[model samples]
Target: MNGPRHRIFSPITRAGRASGQRGAAVFVVMLVVTLLTGLGIFAVRSASLSTMASGFNRQLTQTHYVADYAVLAMVGELGLNAQVHSTNMTSGGSTQCVGFAELVAADKTPSCAQYGYGELNALAQTYSSQELLQPPTGTYPATVVPGSLGASPLEGDMRIEVTDWHPAWPILPGNDATKGQLGYAMVTVSAIGLVRPNPTGMAAGTWDTASATAAGVESSRAHVVLGPILMSN
Candidate 1:
């Protein structure tokens, strides 16, 4: 009987081994690609949210400024009144005015000739003169009239109110009435402002009319109230 013959097996070939390794490498590359894609998507979402928050904050800030400006304008008008002693007017006795047209007209200046500030001021002056001359019959002894302050875009709506007028607390003795004592007046004004989106894709949403309509980007009602004695004594 012949001795058991041993068949010699060749060692694994380098080319074959390399081919198998290549397959595994491809799988690893695919997995990395998938992970990177997922991260990219998450980054995009986070950025979008941040942008939206920033836009909303800006809008709110603008609204507050608009309201404040309106109240200040009304205060200026009240201050211009010669008959009312700046210091001694009672809160409840102060007047209130509302009207979008009137407000827009009054806001105009010579530099804003196209906006018609002159006409608006004339109208307001006339109205104020009349109101002061006639005075009110009520016990509170104040008038609430409607007048325009300046010219605003047709889309803008504005309203103003003066209130909280009262004789100064801790009235000083020996104060002359002719000069008028210090008095307080409160003013509230509301306005809406529109914002347009960036055209170059720096911000979300487009500047088109459709985007504006969808976002409801119009300004909200702005209100400001002045407290304490405003009129002079």
Candidate 2:
């Protein structure tokens, strides 16, 4: 019995060690799978957010262009000495024409197209400036243009107004009647321009409505000087 019995290896101990090792390996694999899943979800969410931001930016730019065009068109109509009827005038004085006209002696009236330019009104003279800034109330009914706004499926409608108007030069010389006949007077006017989104891509006035423009609407208020048009007798 003597010479120290050599320690014998226990199968149970060896089996326990192997089982613990297998448990650790399984836990590591599960952790790796969970991490991969988390990464995939994060990537997908980032992509979705990016797409949404891109879309919004595109829409904003479109609105800006539409508004700019509205301003240009309005200028073309008023700045180039376009003929206007008194009944057709919407904003200015009800009886003064925009173009040059002689003051008729019989009627004691300036011989204008129809009426004088509407008084130079303040900003947002036509629509509520507050409501024009946000969604829901910001959008307005599409105005009919004589022709297309340009391009297909992308054309939009517009809203424009004259925010300020007045004579820019050649002031009447202390009511001098003689000067009126010999001298000429110039006039300048201000205007505002806006545009709305048309999802249906239909022609102006055909599908444009207040309710339809309640969303995705954009507005622009511009103080544009039409010019010193020659008004003379």
Candidate 3:
């Protein structure tokens, strides 16, 4: 057998090879850290946006219910006073008249000066001012059914202001019908709702005094003009 041959070594030493491998590993680790950081930021931003949207949506929903409730309650309350009267004539005949809120004629209406809305709105405020007391004032006047509790996260109010009135109808012969006029009234209602972030004091978290102001709040409002209800004598 011929003499064993020795292999020549390259210029790069083992230490150099190990150092190169270590550098590559370091680069990979840095890349992974950067990617994780980006993902974390994205997650935080998405969560924040979602929270804001949720808050806004909650306010909108609450306001919608508030408006709907206000309208329905107003109508229901006025409906209770509705009346149907039949006047009998001397000739043994009769006429029917419905008494809802008072009726308003075209000529004698005035603007809603109380709420600062001018004549631009279809229904104008008339009749002398009466004290329409609302219990527990808030962003608006809401009639709370008996024993219902309110929460702080959402605050709201509803109010109905009567603006006009009309006399009852369908008179019998020689009957002074206007003396016992059924209710014919026009009204305007307002419903307002508000929501705000939980206060720092409300829960356990690291909170700064300045952060309390930064906490966001949202609000929603609805208004409607309601009309002529039949009132009883």
- Compare the candidates by lDDT and give the number of the best one: 2
Rate residue 207 of model 1 by lDDT.
Answer: 34
Model 3 lDDT per residue over 26-119, tens place? 9999999999999999999999999989866656665565445545544443344333111111112212111111322333223221211121
Residue 17 local lDDT, model 2: 92
Model 2 lDDT per residue over 1-233, tens place: 56977977799999999999999999999999999999999999999999989866765665676566555545545544432321123233433433323333245443222211122122234534331122222223454322233321344445444322433344444544543433323223222223345455444435556525532445544443332333343
The C-alpha stretches of model 2 lying farther than 4 A from their native spots are 1-9, 81-155, 169-218, 221-233
lDDT of 1 at 93: 32
Query: lDDT of each prediction vs. the true structure?
Result: 0.41, 0.44, 0.39
Best by TM-score: 2
Indicate whether candidate 2 or candidate 3 has the larger TM-score: 2
By lDDT, the candidates rank as 2, 1, 3
Q: Any runs in candidate 1 off by more than 4 Å, and if so which?
A: 1-26, 82-158, 172-174, 177-233
lDDT score of residue 22 within candidate 2 = 100
Clashes of 3: 19
Error of 2 at 222 (Å): 4.1
The number of residue pairs in model 2 that clash at the backbone is 12
How much does candidate 3 score in TM-score?
A: 0.42
Q: What would the TM-scores of all predictions be?
A: 0.39, 0.49, 0.42
